[model samples]
Target: MQSISELLKFLTGTVFAAMPRDMLRELVLPHGHVALLSRRRADMIISRVRMVAGLFAVLTPLWIVIDLLVFSWPVTGLLVAGRLVTTVAFGMLAVSFRKSIRMREAYKALAMMFGIPTLFFIYSHPLLSHFDMAGPAAAIAAGYAFLPFVMIAGLAVFPLTATESAVFAMPVLCAEALVALLQLDMLNWSSHLGAFWLLFLIATVAALAGMSQLSFMMSLVRQATHDGLTGCFSRTSGEELLDIQFHIASRSGAPLSVVFLDIDNFKKVNDTYGHDAGDRVLRTMTEKLRSNLRSGDVLLRWGGEEFVILLPNASGATATSAVTRLRDIGLGTRPDGDPVTASFGIAERIADGVTDWHQLVEIADQRMYEAKMAGKNRLVGCADPIQYEAVVNA
Candidate 1:
C-alpha cells in the first residue's frame, strides 16, 4: 500500500509538472521560440520538429500513391495531381525546418504542415448507391476519424504544444465535416459529434505529452548548467557565459572583470564538522553571494571551495568593490553561527592587449593564490589607475 501510494504521488507530480503552460500564452499571442521559451530548449525542440516534419513530408506522397494503387481507393485523377503538388510543398516544409527556425516561425510552419495534408485528403463521403463499398467507406471513415490522433502523434514526438496541435487539428476536423456533409448530401450529426469529442481527447493527450517533454528538457538543462549542491552555475556554464560576455564586451567596447574567491580553510570546516555541515556552508555562502550580485553578473561554482564571478561592463575597481562588499557582509555566518571568510582575486580586460577570457580568469586565479599566500582572509587585486587608458594608448 505504501509503495502504491508513492508511485501514485510520483505519477501525479509528473502529470502536473509536464502540463504545457506555454501553450496558453502562445495560442493567444504568437512569438518566436526564443521569446516564447528558453533559447536552449527552443533550439532543441525545433531540431526535433524539423526531423519529424521532414520525414512526413517525404513519405506522405508515397503513402498516397500506395493507397491508390495497391488498395484501389477511389480518388479523382485531378485530386491525385493536386496531392502531388501539395507533396512538393510539404517536402519544402521539412526542408525549411532543416535549418534553425525561431519558436514562432516553427510553430506556424509546422501547423501548416500538419493541416495541409488533411485538406488534400478531403474526399466527398458520398452515400454509396451500391452497398458493395460500404465496408470500405466505413473503414475509411474510421481512419479519417483517427486523423487528429495521427496529427497529435507528431505533437508527442516534437516540441509542439497542444494549442499548436489544435491549430493543425482544426483544419482537418473541419475538412472531415465538410467532406462528410458533402458525401451524404446532408449534415451527419454523428460524424460532427465524434470529431468534437475526439478533438477534446486529442488535446488532452497532446498537452500532457508537450508538458512532459518540456519538463524533461528544462530539468536536463538545469542539471547540466548548475551545481547540484548549491544551485550555482557550474564551472562549464560560467566559462560559456564568460566567453559570450567577452565577445559582447569586445564588440561593444564595454569593460569586463572577473573575481576569484576561495573560502578560507574550507577543508578544515569539512574535517572539523562533517561533509553535511560543509555542504550547508557552501549552500548558505552561495545564497549570500547571490543576494549581493546583480542579474547580469554570474556566479559559478568553480570547484569545491572556489567560486568565480563574471562581471560584464565592470572594471577591476568594480570587481574589488564587489568582493569588499562580500567581505563586509561576512558571507553569512555558517550554520553554527561561526564566522567564515573568503580570499578574493580580481582581474580586468583592457584594450592595450586583448587577451583571451581564460587568461583574464587565470590572472585573477593567480591573484587569489597570492592572497592565500599572503594571508588566508584578505583580497589581492591588480587594477590600472586609468583602466581604459591602455586601450586609448593602443
Candidate 2:
C-alpha cells in the first residue's frame, strides 16, 4: 500500500510537470493581464475602459431581464449601482494609468489602485445580501474567483522578482486551501465548478508568465538594436541591416546609396556649451534625420557627431539630391542658438561584386572630409572620381 501510494504521487507530480507553464499562467492570471502589457498607460486605460463598457453592455441587459422575470426591482437597482461604480472606477483607473505613464512612476501604482477596489467588491459584495452567495462556501468560491484578478494586478504593479511572486503566491495558495477545506466538508463541493475554477486559475498564471517573458525579451532586443541616447539604430546593427539591403539590391540590380554626415565644429559646441548642450544637439539632429528621411531609409548614429543614412533603391544622382536637401535642412537650424552646419558625402554601389558595405562607408567618409576641408556645409558625391582622388590624397 505504501509503494502504491508513492507511485501514485510520482505519477501526479510527473503529470503536473508535463503541463506547460504558459497554460498554467493563463489559468491563474486575470483577464486584465492584457491591459498591463500596453506600451503606454493611455493604451492600458483605453483597454480597461473597453472592458468596463463591454461588461456593462452584457450585465445591464441581463440584470433587466432578471428583474422583470423575478419582479425584483431592488436587485436590479443594486446591479445598476454596481455597473455605475465599475464604470467610474474604470475611468479613474484610466486617468491614473495615463498619469503614471507620463510621470514614469512605479508601474504598480495604477495596478494597486485598480486592484484594491476590485478585491473589495469581490470580498464584500456577497456579504451585503444583494448578491447570491452568503455562507462560508460562497466566501471560499468568491475568493477563488478573485484570485486571478489579484494575481494579474500584482504582476502589473510589482516587479517580476521571484520573492514578490512567491509572496503573491501565498495568498493564492491560501484561497485555494480555503476552497479545498469547504469541499472536504461536503457543504458546497460541486466538482464541476471546482474543476472549472481550478482550470481557469491555472490558465491565467501560465499566460501572465508568458507575457512577462515576452516583454523582457522585447526590452532586451530594443536595447541591443537601438542607441541608448538618441533611440536610433546603433552603428553596428545599422551596418548589418545595410549589408542585407546591399545584398538584396545587388541581386535585383537596383541602386543602393549611403550618405555620411558629420556635424561641422561639433567639438567647438561641446567645448563652449558643455556636454548637456551637445547631447541636446545630437538629439535634435536625430529628430531632424528621422523626420526628413524616407520610410525605407534608415538613419544611424555612426559615432560621435556623425550619422549614416542608407537609402535603398536610390541612384547616385538621387542620393546626392537627398543629401543636399538634408544638408540644407540640418544647417538651417541652430540647436543651441549658435551657428552650426553639417558636411555630407554621398555614395552609391553602382555595380555588382561590391559586397562589402564597409568599403562604401569608407568612400563616403573620405568624401565627407573633402567637403569639410574645401568648405563646410557642402555635399560631395562618389561620382566625382577626381575629387575623391584628391580627397584620398589630402
Candidate 3:
C-alpha cells in the first residue's frame, strides 16, 4: 500500500512539474488575478490596437487604386465604397485611442480591428467570384481571400489570454466560413475545405503565440511591481494603485480606506539579532496581515519597517474594526520569541474629506506619528487612538 501511494505521489508530482508553473490563472481566463494587472494589460492592448488600426486606415484606401486598375466600372465602385467605410471605421478607432481605455473598451477595439476586414472580405468575395478574370487580375482578387489569414496572424502582436484570443478569433473564422459557403458554386468543396483547414491551423498557432506573450507580460509585471523582501507591491506601484482606486471611489461615491502600519522598535531587532532575523519578522508580519485581510485589499511595502494597506469601498469604521480584530489576534513572533507589534494609522476618503489620494496618505502618516507618540502598538484613526496601555502596564 505504501509503495503504491508513493508511486501515485511521484506520478502526480511529475505531471505538475512538467506544466509551466509561472503560467498564472490569467493565462487561461480572460480576467487577471488582480484588477491592476488587468488594467495595465488593457492599456497595452489598446495602444497596439490603435497603432494597427491606424496602419489599416492608411493602407486600406490605397487599395482602391488596385480595384480601379484590376476591375472596371460598377465592381470597382462597390469595392471602393466598402473600402471607404472600413477606412473610416479604422480611422475613428485609431484617433479615439487613449491611455485610460478600460478592458471592455480594449476588447471592443480589438474586435472592430479584426471585424472591419472580415466585413470587407464577405462583401468583396462574391463580387470577385462573379468575374471570370485571368492573369494579374485573378491574383489580385485572390489576395482578398487571404484577409482572414492576415487578421488571425495579427493576434500574435498583442498579449492576450487563450480565452481572449479564441473569442476574438471566432468572428473572423465565421466570416471566412460564411464567404466559403457563398462561393461554393464558384469553387469546389475540396478547395474550400483545404483553405479552412489551413486557416484553423494558423489561428491555433496565433492563439498559442498570444498566450506566450501574456506569460512573458505576467512575469515582467510581477517582477516590476512586487518587492523582493516581503512580496508586497513596491511603493511606485502602490502610488499608482492609490491614484486609480481613489479616482474610482471618488467617481462612484464609495469610501476608500488607507492603513499605515509600522513595526515597533524594528531597528533593535536588526541591532541585536541581525538583519536576517529582521527579515524573518518582516516576512512573518506580511503573512499574518495577508492572511487576515480581504483578497481585494492591496498591501504595499512603503519603506523599511513600513507598509500601507489600501481597502477599497471600506469606511473608516470598517477598517478600524478589522484592524482591531487583527491586533487582538496578534501579528506574529519576533526573533526574541516575544510578540511582534505595530502602530497603525487609518484614514478614510469620505470621513477625511480629502481631495486627493496624496492627502489621504498624508493624513494616515500623521496619525501614525500620533500612535507612535501616544505609546506604540496602538491604532489612531478618525477619532482617538485605541489604548493598550492597561494591558502593557499589567
Candidate 4:
C-alpha cells in the first residue's frame, strides 16, 4: 500500500510536469499576466476585425461563386443563410470593435462575446460541406482561439512570482483547453488537418506582426513624453499637463499652483565631485521629491538641474506648504554621502485674472531665482504681487 501511494504521487507529479509550461504559468502567476493579456486581447480583437473585414471582402465574391456553381438550389439556400449569419456576426464584431476603441468593454468580455460566438457560427456552417471549405474554417477557428493561449504562455518568460504565474496561466490554460475541445468536436478531423495547421501558422505570423507594431508605438510614446534620466515627464510634456490643469482650474474657479525648483550650486557639485556624482545627486533628489509629493501632483525635469511641480486644485497656502516639504527633502544627502540642496519658487494662479500657463511658469521661474538670490535652501513666494516686490526690494 505504501509503494502504491508513492507510485500514485509520482504519476501525478509526472502528469503535471508533462503539461504545457503556459498552462502551468497561468495557474501559478496571474495579475501582471492578466493585465498584459487584457491589453493584448483588445489589440488582437481590433486586428481580427480588420482581418475579418478583408476576409469578408474576398469571401463575399467567392461566396457568390459557390452559390452559383457548386451548391445548386438547397446548397444555395444554405449559402444565403451562411452569408446572412456571417453578415450579422461581422456587424456585431464591428459594434464590439467600436466599443473596444472607446474602452467601453473589457477585452475578455469582448472576446467571450464576439470571438467565441463567431467561432461557434463558423463551425456550425452547413456550406462547409466541401472538404476544402470545412478544413480552412476549422483551421481558422483553432488558430484564432489557440493563439491567445500561446501568447499568454509567453508571459512565463517574464519575471513573474510563482503565485502570479499560476493565476495568469489558469485562465489561459482554460482557454487553450477550450480550443482543444473545439478542435476535436468542431473540426472535420480527416480532411482538413492541413488547413488547421495552415491557420495556426498564419495566426502566429499575424500575432507577431501586431505585437511588434504595438511595442514600437508604446516605446515611441514613452520616449517622447518621459525624461531619459529620471523617467518623469519631460519639460514640454509637463507644460502640456499644466495647460490641462490650468483649463480645469479656470473652469472650476479653483487655484492651480506651479513650483519651480533649481538645484543649489549644482555646477559646483559637478566641478568638485564629478558629473557622475552630480547625476546621482539629481536622481536621488528627484526620487525623494517623488516619494514626498501627493499622488495628484505632477513632477517634471524642467531643464538641467531644475524640476517643475504642478499642483492642481491647490491654493497659495497649500502650495507653499507642499513646496516647503519638498525643499527640505531635496536638501538631504545622496547615497554616496554627497549633500544636495534646492531652492523652490511657489506661485498660484490669481482668481479672475490674466493668468495663463506660461505666465504662471514665468512667475514661478522669477520667484525661484529670488529664492536662490536670497539663500541656497529656502522656499519662497506666497505673497501678493505688491508684497512680493516690496520683499524683493527689502
Strongest candidate by lDDT:
3
Whole-model Cα lDDT of every candidate shown, in order: 0.66, 0.58, 0.84, 0.58
Residue-by-residue lDDT tens digits, candidate 1, 48-92: 656666676677677565446433334434435655777776767
Clash number for candidate 1: 5
RMSD of each: 7.8, 18.2, 5.8, 10.1
TM-scores, all candidates, are 0.66, 0.45, 0.90, 0.53
Worst 10 residues of 1 by lDDT: 385-394
Off by over 4 Å in 2: 1-213, 351-353, 384-394
* Residue-level lDDT tens digits of model 4 in 1-394: 5865575466445434534454454323333232223344456555555455445545544555545554445545665666666666655555555446212243333343334334433443323434343444445423433444344434322333344334434454444344444554345554345444444443333333333333333445557778988877898777767776787788898888888888877888788879888787877777888889887788889899988988888887888777655554445574456566677787888732446899888888887888778765666765652112212223
What's the residue-level lDDT of 362 in candidate 1?
91
Overall local distance difference test of candidate 1: 0.66
Model 4 bad stretches (over 4 Å):
1-64, 72-224, 236-256, 312-316, 334-339, 347-360, 373-376, 380-394
Report the number of the highest-TM-score candidate: 3
**Selected candidate, larger TM-score, 2 vs 4:** 4
Where does the lowest 10-residue lDDT sum fall in candidate 2? 385-394
Q: Write down the RMSD of candidate 1 (Cα, Å).
A: 7.8
Model 2: per-residue Cα lDDT over 1-394, one tens digit each: 5865575466444434544554334323433222223333334433444444455445435544543454244644665466556556644554443434321243354344435344434443343333454455345434435544444443433223233344444454454455445443223557536644654454345334534543453355457778999988888778767767787787898999888889988988779888888888888788887889897788888999898989889988888777656655654345557545777887789832356788888888988888889876667886753232222123
